[model samples]
Target chain A: MKDPRLLAVCCPDWPVVAACTATGTALHVPVAVVDGNEIVSTSAVARKEGIRRAMRRRAAEAMCPELVTFEHDPQRDARFFEPVAEAVEELAPGIEVVHPGLVAVPARGPVGYFGSAEQAAERIVDHIATHTGTEAQVGAADSLFAATKAAHRNMIVPPGRTPEFLRPLGVHELDAPELVDLLRRLGLKTLGAFADVPENAVATRFGGPATRQHRLARGVPERPLDKRRPAPELAVTETFDEPVERVDAAAFAAKLLSERLHENLAARSLACTRLGIHARTENDEELQRVWRAAEPLTPRGIADRVRWQLDGWLTRERLTSGIRTLTLEPVEVVDGTALQLGLWGHDDERAVRALLHVQGLLGPDGVLTPVIDGGRGPREQVRLVPWGDERTPTRNPDHPWPGRLTRAPATLADDPAALEDENGREVGVTGRLELTAQPKKLTIRGRTREVTAWAGPWPVDERWWAPDRHRAARVQVQADDQAFLLIRRDQRWFLEGVYD
Target chain B: MSRSATASLSELGVNPASELTSTTTDHATGRVLPVRGELAGLLPWGGLRRGSTVSVGGSTSLLLALLAGATADGCWAAVVGLPQLGVLAAAELGVAVQRLALVPRPGSDPGPVIAALLDGIDLVAVACPLPPSLARRLTARARQRKAVLIAFGAWPSPDVELTAESVSWNALDDGAETLRRQQIAVRSGGRGSAGRAKNVLLTFGEEEIELPLVAGGPDRSDEPADAGPDRADELAARRATTREQPA
Candidate 1:
């Protein structure tokens, strides 16, 4: 394939900058985004204060006492950077976003139309700066790697001079620390020195990745651009005469808007899987966010997403203005055939609405949904968590619970019953894991039942290593018409549950 | 020409207007859902009637057994206030796990919970004892909503009441501690001429508790029985296992 000149537009310290901009933090403040304990990205002010990328958070803070830290959020960066990408897309129709802060585009068409590669780069930089209010650097070269390096210093290399432009750059510019360190040990300090090594020698020494970069340093691109087809604009928008300041009002409005949007999609038998929500405030501020789900959206699902987004924006984002207009867009859609309907004669559509209404009245956690999990104990087997809040259970069911009952009892008694033998004396289990007496009769709620047949003194010893150790013996007794599973813990007997 | 054509259609005892609206009304509100073997014979209509409350008086096993057939046939069942329900046991009894919802501990007043479930769920099995007024309210709501309700214990009023009169546990005879199978004699009585006592002998095998059609006789082979549903379940199980395997 023919190699076309490509231009890369890059914004520095994008994650920290996006976080600061979203929170309205001043640019002059030193800021860094920390992943675990290391700084991933740092603002210009933080960098100037010797707080660099990958620096330990404690070390960075010590260097700059006033350093502000933000948790690294990829979603926040991508969501906030969408406007910048759109601004560049307006000037150069198709730009590939390699990540949050960087975008690359084929310069052949735009450069020829604008008369010069320099003019095309300037146009992109100007549009992004004017529209997104973010400073950007643009560089043009034959390969993405060389173009990215050129963009770091905002230079447009002339055709066939990419290798010459990259020659004086240090090996560190290759962006592979291990390869760079290896090259440095081999006495190769510059890109020109590394490229001078035989291609076969480099392949035998450093393998595939190093060879690909070696090709880039020699002005040859690894491959052509994977051209992207621009997504269609299938967004539904609505404007309110009055601005919505309250979250509940916004949620209600969002629900209605979702219904309107889904009705349009339903006619075409299409359902959106990935959705983008865009909001415009009274002060002319624009906010955009995207939500993705494993399953395609129903009208109710769309409404839940809109409400969740609104809740986060209003409560956590601390926006300066109220929303005046809102738009719901489908970023990706699939045929409705994958959508499953409720079973025969079941009206789940209405049930979901009723449950959601209940959830709203009661707190979100007031209503719960149940899921079956593998476990030994009666209470441990089924997990119940508030609807929409699915979490892993505290107990791991995969482990072998050695002393659990082999057969699950049919019913769990509301409360444990007291047991006694025919002598009208209480039955008990001793420390030796032996029954004190042969269990005979069972009494529950004042009713005494005669036990005709009885089974085990099956002992269970649990958590012997912990402070709270438990020792119990279980027995199966057939009394009157009902068969009961009784447990003796410590010295007393309590009816654990009933067997149906 | 159109008027003569319409007139001819109406004259043939086929009202053109009724034909257009007939499809909507054909969804019978009182239609009975087909159930498994002897349990079918126990009911007056040979199946579970919609908009009715049936009492499963004795065993929770009976409730799970009753749900197995309906849930296997793609009906959704909601179990409320029965926290100790052995859902794994229900799965072994052939109930579709995907179609089951458990609200084991429906706090304080379970009436609203059952009423809400009745609006959509085909069958609701409630285990808690209901006060007379709340029971009346739920029964009326169930009938109006056209959802079948199954109460685990004794209830105030029921269209059909199934009670396990006798339960005999099968032992190894050598006095080994393991208990194998259980045979329950369930008697159904309640409501209109349906009060005629009906008895069913259900045998619990390794996998399922089935009502043998001939009381104490050998198995019959006429009915395709569970083959169709079993194949569907196999396909679903195969799909699930394949998905769990790493690529």
Candidate 2:
């Protein structure tokens, strides 16, 4: 069998499992986890007290009474780690997530591209540590399973020893309940055991499943490279094993539903930009809410949205007791792209999100792409817009945009002396225009500058349309010497953009 | 590494040779015990390598550091007495805390617990309150599995590795001056069999760095003390805390 890249992940908590399943790939690396404080990992006392890995918190406590617990955020762990995965992607093609704790990537191209598999693995580990703020160990091998085992083993498998490396690992590394049980029944405890078993007999005993077990033991290919495709973006509806009533039951159902939804998304490289949730009560009534993935579109974010949707739908909407079924749909798709962290391709998603917003506002042709425009003024010469749709990139494509001389300002002073340069020397913002230095009004230089060319109060009414959809007040302003366009949205005045 | 095998074997309920080979078998030879099989690997002796006591003086960062590398090597290690070991810290540190034991104390006496571990257990930590005598005994038992015994400071045992002395390179903030995480100014007693040693310069990144004041000597060569296996300066400058004596 040819060598297949293996990505091994170890997610000891349910949140990790939920996150992993959402992403679709069998691999993941948890940055931080919720309920980590309570896990009774391998320890002298833990062994004596009879605790086990992947045991429920309550079960672990039962084994060793008084087991203290810690509640951490898995979302934070996922959020923190997307950068690492993105960083690794710089070295290879798309990552194939095996679990929330593991991912398998093709090694030939990366190794050959970088001159050697060892160097690539080393670079990946270093990049992840520096770019994503998480310490990771990367191993490359001919097979996905072998690679996963090697990674968990923390020994970067030299190109040739993948099969030899896997020989010693136990079969349970597969961690699939029924498969593991069958293998155990056959006394095939280790990869060596499966490797030693006759392929024909093994298949006869475990049927089809055993063949996979054999191939994995031999470092065989499981799946092809991760092809970014638009799989069916669908809704998941879960019915209780037993019909459940009560708001708590409904909430629990939502949690389960959200976990399933996230698992599907994670497995397929997809994220729902918009969501619509529905609950079927035991009384046959339905409670539903049309929502959005909100900010960042994380599993926790989705869960929060579900809870918020439930709260309003249940209390404000006055839905009565007990929900029998719950369904969630990914109404729209956004770039929810996997993160790339590091110098190679570590572009911040916040920047992407901002660009997406700009693109949405100005049709594709209305916005211009980011171009390096070096200019002397405060307004940046760089203009970013929706790709292909020509809004002509009217936004300044010049360096040192006015008002935000550092990042691209909204309004500029008649005289540069009025700018605030407190920490300017370091950040390159050399002006000292403290606009609010006195009252709500300020003197730019000698002349008092007031609001000039205006737009909003047009109340360009938004969600005027969707309730709670008003994000900010976008006021297009143009002063004489300085052209200013400001957005007084969400109570703060940010130069929504500049039109120099 | 043997500890993890033994643990998994035990988890699978597989029984093995019921005898302790001479003090040199790479993995411990024994009957697999029915436990979650926590295999925080031993140093190939029996328990924690000496000089492994990290001062858990209430800082979460330090506490997590203590259990972070419990399984850096493929060993089955168990922290018996330290029940309050932070789970999140351990997980983040790459230590699988799912099999940890939350015991008030391992046995009626720390000696018996040590004996149980020494009998056949691979890398079991019996967390009794640390005293010099208890540290010595626990350290004695750890010699078999080459296990690491990291006891808390409230039980300050003289025998364990005082890791803070080795890794802290920066100066300390005291009345006289301040210290960085990269260097520490040492004060020694200069007495005893270990010899009179005073004012030792302690540098960071060393395998083991003691305050150089002990009745016997130092044991800072363990892998966990200085995680970087690539430092020679760390090997040459190791000093025993017992070397500190009254001149």
Candidate 3:
């Protein structure tokens, strides 16, 4: 079967462009957007100075000493490209964004309207350049993948000649690096050469994924598009009584809407791959953006995308009023079986349901799970995370924390205690780590107990270089059958934990 | 085959005793969650029986130790209203903290919260006090759900009641060294098979020891040994000396 004809719009070095626009850097300046320590994208000027994608930041800096760098942020890229997408959408009504920098639209409508594919491409490119002040290249072919490749080189492939256009392209065009390397080693250096292999041979030799790539090389759709019109009920909408002006409030609403959308999809044995977020402000203005992912989106993934989109709209875009209505729609979906749970362990479905029910009764923070974090004191070592939230420790537990108690107390307490010497004088630690007087009795909450055995004054001088430096001494004292972990600070003794 | 025919066949040759034994064994194994270490001796079923309510009093470490074995074996446990529970100490006692949930503050009434947890979780330990009527209803719900309900304080009536009679710390004297271990004398009493009160001395921290086995009781020799040989030998010597006296 023949693939549908589509037109793709590509913006070269979009990340660099987005970074420049966001920071108001001149377009002619050498700029690079870096992720971690590697340069992910470079401007045209930076490329001329010997800086390339995936190059070390230090090496790039050494090549172009005047280069300006920005940390790679996908939200910023999407925010800056919103205007460009708006420009393309103005010319062609139905456009699907492949990503922040690329978009695709069905070729039939624009081609027929403009009298030819080339004219349509030229018109769209010209419109985007004039409206958004960003240079764009447009190409049309029998498939979106081929059109994307064509757009990169500013070429238009004839409708029936996508395969002929892809023939001389390098195997790297398949975008499967490992498979391309293998194909290169096997002397299949171009798409035509790889496509020349028999379908059965390719299947038997390279397995399933390679078979799909083989079909792509042959210029056919990898899989039959099974686009289904999602049920109207699947779209979750929330109308707030009060307009949401805060980012946190919008994030909370986004989380709820995403969860509801996920539940709706999961109920029908479906998972969304493309999601559309729409919002209506009190000023009667409408905002929309569609996000696409290669894999099906989990609830958390959907929530994060919605949050980022909302953040971009509220902060970056000028709005006369706060958002009044928010909606989350699943634009495309796949089989829910793709979202698999762990097969080995016992199912936590029951516990999760019960905890969620409890959370309903007493907010989200009522139910929590403990995570052991790194610290010297017992209280600082454990952090309680909300039940459904990610379980990440605030501090790394692998660090060697000297002066930490080897034996942790079974119970933590915040009680005030007084230590007295033989003559009923308050006991204190001296500057030289000496005891002013031997502790004989410990009084807690008006109850006096004799101290049988005690250990002392393990001083912890933490953050000594900072202005808010903390200086405290810990002592372990055994009063009869109960042991107390006492901390001395500001000339007062407090009970931190009890060995019960 | 008809019901009467199967009954006639059973009457002719089937051994009813063997059938009863097999059913009882399956029922016991399916209904109980295993508890390891010295604390296992305190329960009548040798583990935590489903639908049963157990009360743990006196020592927080003892409660954490009770949860350690089951949680380590992959059981999910939730603790309600235990804000001061030293989670690090629970980890030290061999509890899998990942499978454990904490509801430090369950609001004014914790009945519904604990009921919800008992319906799904394998075990629900509650420190908040409940009215006698509500406790009874929760016990019934626990039985229906086949989950264990543990009360950290007094309950209406529990299947097993464990109390730490006395506790003493070891390996420290006059600040020379840190505390290394603790010996707790736990006394277990309950209804039915556990009606006869029993006392067992358990050693916690560094090394765990269950000394002076009850006569005719289940032997735990087949359980995997987690302590070193020297520690095991020392425990054995202590066990021998303790066995000479009545427990």
Candidate 4:
């Protein structure tokens, strides 16, 4: 990695300037791209004008009456720079992208091949212009910072001329803005003036990091050449002309997406486990569902989960109305090895399919898996939820979880029932009825029972601070034949759950 | 494709009474029975089958209470479109509302919607305002599919063998609100066309009554003109407020 260098081609108004650039036509950044102090655009001409980006729109318009404003498009910008990255990759396989429009390619082999460093840079810039009809600028230095600075400023300081080239630049180039301003206040502006100052004086003011920078200003780059790595894997999508209401239809579309994803992954021979399904509703509610398969998922599995999650909204649940778009993003991929299928089949995926089928039949909570959390209270410790929906775990597992119950009740009380008194007459039930004390007998369905053993009138006072969601207490009791978990708050006895 | 499942469903014919009952996994052993009806002979099988749709006429509460008895031993049950029913009360009555899903039928796709819903979940009881064709289809499907199909009205279909009707014994028309809110009545009759089972009078919520089979009378007469569909409506209205009986 000898004399490795970095190259950055800034397209200040790439989206605004890319239609012609994509096909190799336009190259210059638009005038008035920047509105003020800010680099509102990559336009070289815009930088010369006082107009900067994001300054008062009126202010920008006043400076340049015919200035064109273009909406930013990441896709177009990426497409515009693809040839540039490819051109660099052609020179050397080792390349890294800092951004869609900025890339760094190693200059060692290419420089050596083209005779000398200057000749190599000139030939490469010529190649870039021929391939991508844009004025190509090349900068060569021992370090990426120096190379980037040279290209950004459009200077071609020859190989061994770095120290002399940096001598006249201001000290602020080395990131000592405060010190540079202080020196300028005292009427010292250039790097040569700073180099003339005692090294001890500079060290005493700016500390250790400043001393490191002092050496770099003498044209010595400290950054090491990095081994080339492939660009990050990303999934892309397109919207539909019409809304889709069926789950299978979404899966069908996602299958098409899977092909695109496979193409991207196969290019690098990689796979991922985590997938993201993004659905944009007609009402503009951006709903995102993430698929986290325990193992690598086939396109079908991805599609099924995507469809079911879409089922959670599009078909199964009522959407606001129409759908605007859909997106399937395999956000995270895993390093997967080729599987050697030992037999005609593997583990049964059919069981899970059947289980999901039955659950759909038996309402939501028909089939449940028992989940145990770190809670002392029986009810809080164990939760029996349908299948998915792991969102509402028993909270406060670490605290002395109260009450004595088994799994969380399969059903929640939609409306508070009228608790009956001893005579089976309706009584008042304003809040959660928790029996602070053990009831002597629990009569259910006109059948009276005895309370054999009991745990607590554990005051489960959750969200006492939140006025809307104030739950009180639940006391667990064991009878001769049955075990009941009783809940109470404002002095009443009603069973909330069972132990079986 | 394997043809076993469909054949098995056909082998197990439908029973009327158990159409809306859910099976409970016995607490002691986890043993599960497909149906549990205390009075099985009242329906064809003495058990309600899964996937069947049944309709019972008159009040919605009767169907709920009947289902409550079938599910009391820990079975699961579901009731669709009992619009006035309080689900929590059903849960407490031991009818596993957690195992239940109440579908809202605000419009009239009453037949198809109900059938499609039954296709997914076990149809315990569907409280619907069904027409004759829908009622007939539900009855026929319940028998073949081994599911219990019940309609809300006593509009009998040839598919039904036994029917329980709860009626208010003495609810006379008055210009005012209920003069009396006591004394419920019930009557049980089977195979009006076949003419076998008798009316079992039950003074509900009081002392029980016995069965006295009487045909060729106004209530169960062969002649449709004596009391047609309009009479059925009048009978239904009278049964709503007054106490009920079984024949």
lDDT of each: 0.67, 0.42, 0.76, 0.45
Model 3 regions lying over 4 Å from their true place: A1-276, A290-305, A318-321, A328-346, A431-435, A461-468, B1-30, B207-247
Off by over 4 Å in 1: A1-370, A386-401, A414-417, A420-426, A430-433, A445-447, A457-468, A489-492, B1-31, B83-89, B104-113, B126-146, B153-157, B166-180, B205-247
User: DockQ values for all predictions?
Assistant: 0.08, 0.01, 0.23, 0.01
lDDT of 1 by residue, A103-128 (tens): 77788878888899889888888988
Instruction: Kindly indicate the candidate among 3 and 4 with the higher TM-score.
Output: 3
Compared with the true structure, what per-residue lDDT tens digits does model 3 show for residues A416-494? 8899999999988665344588899999889999988776555444332233645466778888778888888777888
Candidate 4 residues A1-500, lDDT tens each?
35435443333345445544545443453443332222345455544556554465556656766555544544455445656655665665555443444555556666668776567667766776787655556666655556656766656566666667777887677654555667778776766676666656656665434544555665555421221233444665758777766656765676566655644553343444556667787778776545444334444455455554554465334566655687767655643221101000111122223223333334334444334444433344545554323323334333332222222332222222223444555433233232223235665555666655544333354232244654455444445544445565454556665432
| Reference contacts preserved by each model | 0.19, 0.00, 0.55, 0.00
User: Which of 1 and 3 is ahead in lDDT?
Assistant: 3
Q: Which stretches of candidate 4 lie over 4 Å from their true place?
A: A1-290, A294-325, A329-500, B1-38, B49-54, B58-61, B65-78, B106-108, B154-186, B192-247
RMSD for each model, in Å, please?
A: 19.5, 28.1, 13.4, 26.9
Candidate 1 per-residue C-alpha lDDT over B57-161 given as tens digits, one digit per residue, 9 for 90 to 100? 777777888888777876778787776776655655567755676676677867777787787678888888889889888888889987888988878879989
| Best model number under DockQ | 3
Tell me each candidate's TM-score. Answer: 0.49, 0.28, 0.65, 0.30
Clashing residue pairs, backbone N/CA/C < 3 A, model 3: none
Q: Give the poorly placed runs of model 2, Cα more than 4 Å off.
A: A1-3, A6-51, A56-59, A62-66, A70-77, A90-93, A224-500, B1-247
Candidate 3 residue-wise lDDT, B1-247, digit = tens: 1223323333343422422322336335657777754665567666788889999999888888888888887688999999999998888778899889999999998888888899789999989988899999998999899999999989888988999887677634454455556767788898887776877777766543222131121344565433222222332333344334433
**Model 2 residue A282 lDDT score:** 72
